[model samples]
Target: MITDPEIDGDWDTAQGAESPERLTPRERARGGPGVRPWLWALGGLVVASAVWAGGLYAFGDRLSEPTLSYRPSKNLCEDFKARTLSGLTGDLHKQRPMNQESDHPAVYGAVCRLNNVEGMPDFVVAAQVDLHKKTDPSTEFDVPPLADIATIGDVRAEAVSDLGERAVVLTSFGGTEQKLKVLDGGAVFTVQVSVSTYNEKNGRPATDATAVQAAMIEDMRALMAALRK
Candidate 1:
């Protein structure tokens, strides 16, 4: 049979050889095989991987997206009044209930600040609720820098729990302050409660970090329990 000039052997001899084992080196070297079977297999595997990636890119939204819950309150100040302190009426004590609305209806936030009467301590509670339409399962909730992971019941937080129950605290965004966060449904609620005392002699704000933490924890726990109800 005719064979290509570049090939080392005749096409007939290469094709009709008894077996690969019997073929001479020259015969085995030519009829210039189009491509090896392993090469074909590798190409097929690559094609399959590409198809899988394309499919994922095209239809990923329909797969694995988490459905979140949304809850809105009309009167956040009245709701948090009793939970904050006894005989503390938002109306009676210069209560400032702040409300902010976003373009996305799924996102909602509210804050209620109860100021102290010059000598006593102050209390502020804020809540943010986000109902995400989609969620990344591979994502990680990274703890804030220089913070330790802590737990209150089943809730996890980044906090410092070195002090006794009288003062369990966590540092928050605004420097060293006590804070806590809890995840419910598809919503995350973060609460910060801090106490700052004036140093009569030093003329600067003085704080017992551990004591503040303990008080903040109690307030945070109370606020969380109230929100859940």
Candidate 2:
């Protein structure tokens, strides 16, 4: 009853039988037949999670904001029709089809310029549509220092009420321009009606600022209503 040396070899030889390469932390865990498969699976899951987190950190804002597509009716002039003051009215002229262009990330905008036939003060209407972005339009609602916050035509708006029918204006784009911004259906609609009554060219009064402002408000109101339809 004798035991062979090869069969009952040294424990060091048995341990070194697998491989001589240096094993990494993961490789060490995958060394033997007795190694649990769940551990390998868990390691894989951890790697996947790290990749996903990195992606989110890199592109969070862009992924959240949706891209806007263009449509023919979304053109600036066509969507916002040309209008003139009722009594002071002459001929209403609409410029070329205002193309919808990207204003900012996830925001598309366009403006339609309208000129008076009688050489009166001109008007411009602009629209900005947010392409399903979660951005709040109220950020653009900031008015001038003394501007009044009032409700016009069932919508709460910030305006220069003291202008008293001369102009319904607000501060925007770093408070450099005076305009109207209406937030509706993931879009911001803006209107700019000239407040000048005296023609700069002839130095004579042409269109009434008060009348032009009133007409601008009504025209904007009508456009907003149309968007709802």
Query: Best lDDT goes to which candidate?
Result: 2
Q: After superposition, how far is residue 178 of candidate 1 from its true place, in Å?
A: 2.2
lDDT by residue (170-189, candidate 1, tens digit) is: 46444344565545444454
lDDT of 2 by residue, 35-134 (tens): 5689889999999999999998876754444332223235555656535433344433432434455555545555565554334544333443343355
Global lDDT scores for all candidate models: 0.46, 0.48
Candidate 1 shows a clash count of: 2
Q: Which stretches of candidate 1 lie over 4 Å from their true place?
A: 1-34, 37-65, 81-94, 103-106, 117-123, 136-140, 143-169, 172-176, 198-208, 211-229
TM-score of each: 0.51, 0.44
Candidate 2 Cα outliers beyond 4 Å, as residue runs: 1-73, 84-89, 94-100, 103-105, 117-132, 143-168, 171-178, 199-205
Q: Name the weakest run of 10 consecutive residues (lDDT summed) in model 1.
A: 196-205
**Global fold similarity of model 2 (TM-score):** 0.44
